[model samples]
Target: MGLIGDYRRLMRAGIALARHDVILPGAYQTRLPLPARIAGRVLRIFGGGARGRPGERLARALEKLGPAYIKLGQFLATRPDVFGAEVTQDLGRLKDKLPPFSMKAARAALAEEFGEADAARLFAELSDPVAAASIAQVHKMSLPEGERAVKILRPGIEHKLMVELSAMKRAARTIEGISAESQRLKPVAFTETIAAAMMRETDLRLEAGGADEMHEISHKSGHFVIPSVDWDRTGRRVLTIDWIDGISLTDPKALDRPGIDRKKLANDITQGFLTHAIEYGVFHADMHEGNLIITPEGKVALVDFGIIGRIGMVERRFLAEILWGFLKRDYLRVAEVHFEAGYVPASQSVGEFAQALRSIGEPVHGKPAEEVSMGRVLLQLFDYTHTFGMSLRPELVLLQKTMVQVEGVARAIDPSHNIWVASEPVVGSWIRRSFGPEGAAKLVAGNVKEITNRLKRLPEVMDRFEASLEPPAPPPPPPRRFAPWWGWFGFVAILVALGIWAAK
Candidate 1:
């Protein structure tokens, strides 16, 4: 019954998508089955409104489906390799804008997160929601000196998302069963990845912690801004932070903002994102222009900490070197990095792979940042998988997505922004510092410390081994039979006779 209900809901959502010409339209129309093609035509005839751009149509269809579906679209946007660039870009454009729930529901959620007494003390005045998304809503709260942005999760979001996810899982299973080719795509694993990310966002504490950590990291760079979290006022469902008033990076008017340094803003955003990812190993994964703001004082402020990404030292080094190689027009090094990182199989020729990379890098190298087609670069890189049998690394998906979005934001602010130059100050210095002699010494010291610790525990391990080797008590001797004594006497007599004969 539960599955039936979910399937019904999914069908309704599909109909809505078809009616909106999201599923069967433009280039994708050719791939549809005959039945779907006929239905799609009929729906288009009845649907009076002109179809929008592919991305816009997808956004609308996702919006109509519900909050969880909206989130699914956003999650899919990060996977350009699985979905083509056009569809993923459209998914990326899908806004999380949804109508706010009732004020009473908001109050109830806040009260649940914080005890009634604490809730009253923390919040002085709770205004209507100023902004709402698929998962949560934001409201202005009165404070002593300034206002606070209080974010509260929508009621029953977890249950809704779980149901939607189950449907997705079923669909993934069906696809895997139907098509052998789809197995390489790992549809089930992709669905699971989206589910985990969505589930994590439901927890406000983790989100708050991400913001606090980002703030600490950003403070060091002196090029970024992060608002303070009010721990006293924050709760599991509600997160409270100091309000920030700044121009959104998406705003066209930001270009003309008086006293705002657009070029510096562009450099800071690009460099700051890379530094955070490479140097600190943590970054905001969902960094669209909407999540970015330019302060009145010209600082680049980062907000909406729900989705963050982390990478290990090895991945960071690979990313930095790869970007650096492309920037330097060293396609061979770029290809080498991919092979070293096991992105491309060893069977593939390094020289041939380098030549393939050159095709991808040459167009964008040394070009103005705004003019370089990042989408094309990503698409071309994706195309290499067919030639070299390379698969996309799941761990780097968020990083790649964020990098693309960051470049778009930066270029929007400054047209002639040189990605290489903007990135060199942070990425170049990091490479030289991390891969140099001092870096080698640090790496060796870390390994030595680990070995020394293991050696110190060897004595204890030896003692345990010796204790295990100690044998248990021997079993009592078997009782002798009466015949054994007679046999022994005969043997003694025979021995005496033999000894006497030898003596003679």
Candidate 2:
């Protein structure tokens, strides 16, 4: 965007924050220098003051900025690793709920995405939007042959997102230049992540793809179910999936009315996510109460794949071992996982780190299994990582945020829900599957198989390496220049000395 556009957006954001009384007063106070404070005070004379808590004001301001900023704020709420607990909780209130655009606009978006006006004919019904959020909205609709839910991208969300996103990038750049400490957080990289996620979200097609993959993984799992995508009606701007009929986990009264076992429901949600994280290595990052539903038959259904977390084998192993270590009160093992994963700086003695881990773990270990705070334990672990300069993994940040959200939902279902206690069975199974004799045998077999495959490709690998080692062609000769006799003599003398040294 141009400078004028950026100014307009910044002005819009400032105005909106003022209007909604949503400002992170404490954070802003600490962040701004004295000069900035004086300037801010003067500006506030013109900009107006917010009316509520700083955190609330901050969330409202982002929501007012537009869909992209709203989504950014939502993502930020999940990362206590970045903003801390109080601020994250405040931002969590920035609901995606927004007023719906006209049906004409929704129809036009569908027509454009599906490449035909008759595209609406594909769905048995495409009623008015039931729920509207920052990037997309949900409608109670039907597939060509059966019941389904249609998620449609908000009309012109792309253009609005681009405008807001460009402004964000500019703001991040300016902030980076101003704050030396901001470099570690990588404001620029954060902007890139926001941009990338918003771009993917703007295209409903990507959400469909994510749902499809998750569905395959969760298909036979008894604890969770991912709604199947109705590909016939899915496109760039719209996705159709089987409509889930269940009560929100937050609604305990309703769950009870339907005879849904609260404890079982809690387990299903926790263990379900665990299955995704450990077994599939792909998991939904947003598991807030609104996104998760409990079917009458007691199955947990998950939606909203806009933000997902992925872990590699190494990270998953580290996470598993860390959790297992904590479960067994093996603080040393937990510290070792941090070192092995390169999360803790080598300069920080492992013994010291282990002692710190014990500080957090020992108190919890004495408590009954049902009373432990797994999320708090994880938070302490992350705090240690931050203290030691571990580069925060964005995926882990999302995972932690979702874990907190899941805890809230679970606690709402059953205040005494012991996540660590519930998780032990699942974590134990994963550990055995990963480290038991059978698991070790499988590991060895896989390694040997890989070696055999590499040996088969040894000739091809050597050919490529040999080809790469070939000397480069010399550069074109430089234009000849006239030189004095003294220069020539000096060059020749230097060359002679270099040759003599080489021989020596």
Candidate 3:
């Protein structure tokens, strides 16, 4: 039941999708091939009256499937270019919420992580779970210093997730092998990325470290709030952080509070993400409304740092230039950056790519902020990736996904929120600092230092080169050795004794 087991799990998933009318969805039936159309008609009969758009039905199916599928759906929601806006919007609603494990089970997990006596001593006033999600749940506990939230991993989620993810990987491999067109999407790599992120989410220690790091970044940026980690009470399965006493942005009533600046909050959400990514090269990868808390002071507090997006200096420059180009409506510069970043194949024509970029950017410009959709623009840009022979960048997937989430949350807070406008300050400042005269000076200084360092090592490198050029001395003749006469006599004696025994 190795490969067979994967196929069996996939079969079950297929049936679920068929029941939800996601297999050969009705909207595309007319466009499907004759055989596919016939198959779709037959499948719809077993759909159990699944209603809503295909994405909505698929979301229900994935949610019903469990945590792994839910995570996949969330990942797909980030790719509106592949699925379209309406479908992705429906999928975006796939939340991580799940019923909480029992209080007894929660206590047991804590005791197992920290011995029973220590668990009681630390969490004497531990309350019932305040919130629950697919991978873990949070419980509020009181400490002498302050109230803290204790997050515990689900009892047996790791194994369940591993089984489901293995099936998903098999399915991805099957899809890539069967369909040439799917190769550009990199389904195998995509699934692996999601699987890796899901596995990381199970380890609360990593999450604690992420929280602490982001807290420091937040202090410097003053853009968002991050909870302080309680190191003394934390463990691999348990993360203790200062409990945030605020309303989650997920609540419909969250924005209705007095003193809340909806417009400013929206801008802050957009700008905060850009500032973190462009300036610091790290950001909370999961920026969904559920994970964002609007404190009483109206500051956005990010929690559940199970996923964090990071980029190297090269990617940061690529992102900054792209954003800056878009802000200035210089589609050519944007296209050039893509080429320079090696995202677009060298065989592709730069002018043609620039034209495609223009198509995506010009429409959004001069339009009312509420009328424009950053997600839609990204969708078109992703579409161009295929047209321009650009492959999916695994490293940028999380960053792209988080960008969409940030835009969605920001737009929800204020419909008139203009991300491009918000981005200009951060992106523009970064571009100026990175590509201007000051940047040129730093580049020259760096090159000079590099050359000086190499010059210093020249003598050592030359010595090694000369040493290799010289011939090696011949190996010493095999060590001379001689058996003593007594040794030879003993061998003969042994042979004679053997001969006598044989004669007897």
Candidate 4:
């Protein structure tokens, strides 16, 4: 009955999606079998068709399906490789905002995280929630003389997500059974990724910690701004953060108001994003217009630390070299990065991949800034990589999506903004610093420190190794084969008696 109910709900949601007016008029009309059409018709009979722009319709359908679906749509929106640009754009506008929890619920959460009495003493004022989302909401508050924003986790979000995600997994499995394309996507794996990210977002403490780490990393980098956390008022379900005042990066006109240099703003946005990506190896995974703001001093202010991506040192260096190669118009070097990073299978010739890359890079090399679209380059590369049996890497896919968004944001501010120009200086400096003489010294120091630590633990390691090598005592013998002679005879007798009784 539980499985049946879940299947029924999922079917109903599918019908709702089919009827959604924004599904490109005939989204499900792809020469499917008569039975499939009949099933779709049955679904339409249960609900009205979608209405609104394609993207807007998607958002609406997802919202109706529930929080888990909305989140799934959001994740897909970040993958331009999966969904086309139009759909991705629509999903990008799908905000996670939902109604805020009640004061009673919020208080309960606070009490659960930090004793109610302690929470009361920590804040001078506990205002109502000012904003809400799928995982949590923000409340305007005061803490000792400073104004702050308090994010409180929505009550029971974890339970809701788990239930819905289980249904989603089941649905994904059913879809895979019906569609071979879905099999290649590894829907189960993708669902797990979504589930893990959702789980992390539900923990307010983790996000608060992420914000603090980002803030500390950027404290000396004047180009970036991450709000400070008020630790005293922070807890498991609640986060207290310093408030930031800035214009939304999406608002170019407002950004231009009062002498905001569009060029400089564009540079700062691009450089700040890459700096985080290459230098710190951590970057804001969600780079929509909403998460970025431009302060009065023209510094870019980043908010919402729920989603971030990490690339190891090797991958970062490889990415830097790829970007450098592309900028230098060295298709061979760019191809080499893909092979070296194991993005391309060694079985494929570097020369052939370089030729494919040249097809993607050549057309855009001398094009005007406005004429060249990074999206095209990315799409071409994605399609080209498939010829060499290079499967998509979700992390890299996320990075590409982010690059698209960041590039779009920068261009909106300055129509002719050259992304390559902004990236060159930052990427060049990072490369030099990473491989320069000083960097070599730092590397040597790190190796020496590691060696010292290992030497200190040498005795303990040897003792453990010796202990592992010592043979264990022999196991007790099996209990005389479980007296199989009698047990088997009795089992066979019962089966024979049952068969005879059935025949009779």
Candidate 5:
């Protein structure tokens, strides 16, 4: 099925959501259009006692829809401004877990990747799958060198994702077409971003490269542990990496170890993410508790490289300045950064934007770590996006999403975790290095070097400019070709026939 198939899938999805009372939720029914209100009432009849907050109902509906919807829910969880904090929080709880595929199926996949004989030789001691997610599952295997974790993509997940993503794109387009406000959110672009990320996740090769890069970054930062990739055993559908022995952060007992320092661990989570994003410009975008583990050595180990966030130097500066400005309670500077970054429209008043920022910041100024919710603050800030003519920045989606995840994980590790306090040291250090006198000198040097390079190419540039100044030669009299006698006679005859018909 192509377009028709997408419509069918969307219809099914709509029905499922309706049954869960997710589409035009009851609370907002009165405010909706007459037709929509009637539709919601009719759909709610099929709800079958679907109970909970609208977010909860939607999460369950999406989970029931399958992996692609679950991923969509997770992506939507990042936009607390559009969905609201409670709804997004509920969406955030949408797990990627799925029942593990059969061992026979797993072996078949391995054999397909590496010929049967090679698969047998390599995974002779392959154990049962230890964990399974929507896209893939992991198995522990013993290699000649050491123990390795083998990740295998689900058999038909790629095609499944393709179909669902197509339907989602259609839905996003439909939503945008129907609502003027939704255009600012760029639902189509947002869906495409999700689609691209999901497609990338299907290819284990990309994950392997990301894992290796993060491993190197981890080594430098010494704030997190990243397992080494086993390149020899890796393939498009399979990834083999060193098996990590640790308790997952999701385990309640992960932080119960005698030597574990909760406060330090919490700070490390926050600082480590900032350091990678600001300094290295790359980070593990998926930092949920399940992807993190507490090693026996009392270190935090990061896993799952399927989603990595990268930012260029400009975004790095934007992030650092924004964080630093917030830490300093300089709402004006924060607003300036937003304007400089072009996140807000030029038509918006900078002073008024600063006042809005002050509103978000002032309330949390002296509040205790536990009392303040960064997630709420972020929600409010994003809510102002519409007020200030701000649109969604696709490039910063992952960064924003990961920030919320990091904050949540940190708070879980230590309830009193203060992201602002934890971020100050890292953010401040970066600001000092980047905005200080030394930074100015480097900036000027870079500009002068660029100018020097241009000067060297001046003769080449002048030659092109001079060449463009010359007028084009005229067409050579239509190749001096004449139409055949019959052609002209036929044209004259056609004109005469038309004139005769008109007279008649």
Candidate 6:
């Protein structure tokens, strides 16, 4: 976007925050330099003199800023340790509900996904949306097979998200350039991560793919349930899935139906995600109560696969061993896992790190899920990572976030739900499948098979290596100073790099 556009957006965000009374007060903002302190005072004065709860004000301000800001707020809600309880709780409200756009817009998106006649023929009835979220609104529909849930992307959502994210990118760049500490925190990379996710979410097909993959893995586990996507009737801008007949796990009275086992369901949801992540390496990342349902059969049905987390074989093993260490109260082993995963720098002493891990893990070893706060643990972990000069493990952050969310859901389902106790069975099974004698034999066999394949390709591999070892072709004569556009490309690239360095 143009500079004018970004300036306008920044101004609007500032104005909204101020009008809604969302300034950070006390030592936090006052600790800055004199100029910053004065700016803080001005903001506080404009922020309605702290007339309301800061968290609620913040949430309202984000809502006023539009869908992208609301999304940022919802993401922050997942990090209670970072944002504090009041703001997190208020932000939680954003995830459960959002004002619906026009019905006409929904129909237009539906017709665009499928031809008007075809869509009309496929969905016998398109009831009003039962739930609305930032990116999409879901309508209850009837198909020949049965009742289905149809999710339609908001109109012009791609453009809106892109515009907002562009402004955020500029701010992230400015921060990264101004402060080495901010650069170390990876503000730009972090913003890029969020922007990438929002972009991927604009395309409904990716979410459908995630649902299919999750169902495949979760089905193999045979405990949790996932809604079946209606493949034939789904499209890039729309998703149609079997309507789940279950109560929201968030509502205890509605969830506590005859034949339902609340505690078991809680265990299933927690174990389901844990086992799926380890066993298949792919699992749903978004598991808040609204995305979870307890069917009449007492099975946990997973839905809303817009976000998912994946762990590679190495990372999966690393996670399993880390959790196993904590389960056993072995801080040394957890520290070893971090080093082996190359998360902690090799230069750091394992002994000191283990001591630190002990401090973080000691409080939770014997506690139930509801009593233990992994958010607190995560915060401490972040502190240790920074102190040790360790780079943040991007691959595991999603898993960490999902773990917090899953724990919250489990606790809500049964206040006394013990995550460590509930996860023992699944973790034990994974350990056996990954490290037992049979698992070792299987691993060796797989390695041998891979070696055999590589041997078959040995000739081709050598050919490429030998070809690369050959000297490069003689360089062409240098172009004139006023050469063709293509000839100046290298010089232009160097200038761009120089500009970036100077900006930094």
lDDT of 1 by residue, 210-299 (tens): 999999998886658898898887877889898888888778685695787788888889888888998999998888988998888888
- TM-score of each candidate? 0.84, 0.84, 0.84, 0.82, 0.86, 0.84
Q: Tell me the lDDT of candidate 4.
A: 0.76
Question: Whose TM-score is greatest here?
Answer: 5
lDDT of 6 by residue, 1-504 (tens): 799898567556656665664543434665554444444555555455545566777777787777899878766665554455455656766644578878888877777888898877776588998888788899998766788999988888899998899999877776555444455557788788788888898888889898888777766778578888898779998998889988886676886667777787778888888888888888887777788887777778888988788888778888888888888888999999899888889999999999999998888878766667766677678666658876645557767777867877888778888877887888778887889898788789988998999999999999999999999899999733333333234323332333233223
Clashes of each: 0, 7, 0, 4, 0, 0
- C-alpha lDDT (0 to 100) for residue 447 of candidate 6: 89
User: Which is better, 3 or 5, measured by TM-score?
Assistant: 5
In order, what lDDT does every prediction score?
Answer: 0.79, 0.75, 0.82, 0.76, 0.84, 0.75
Residues forming the 10-long window of minimal summed lDDT in candidate 1: 494-503
User: Which rank order by lDDT, best down to worst?
Assistant: 5, 3, 1, 4, 6, 2
lDDT of 5 by residue, 1-504 (tens): 488998778767766776677866779977765655655565666666789998999999898899999989988887776778778878888978899999999999999999999999888999999999899999998867788999999999999999999999977876665556567778999899889988988889999999999999989987799999988889999999999988888886657778889998899899999999998899888888888888888788899998788998778989899888888899999999999999999999999999999999999988999878878888888788779988756547668878888999999989999999899999999889988998778778978998999999999999999998999788667433223444334433433333233223
lDDT of 2 at 47: 33
Cα deviation of 178 in candidate 6 (Å)?
2.7
In terms of lDDT, the best-performing candidate is 5
* Clashes by residue pair, model 5: none
Against the correct fold, how does model 3 do in TM-score? 0.84
Candidate that beats the other on lDDT, 1 or 6, i.e. the better one: 1
lDDT of 2 by residue, 170-212 (tens): 7787656555667888999889987887798887888888988
lDDT of 6: 0.75
Q: Report the candidate with higher lDDT, 2 versus 4.
A: 4
Q: Give me candidate 6's TM-score against the actual structure.
A: 0.84
- Tens digits of lDDT, candidate 4, 246-296: 798656678758778888878888898898888888888787788888877
Q: By the lDDT metric, which is better: model 2 or model 5?
A: 5
Give the CA lDDT, 0 to 100, for residue 87 in model 2: 72
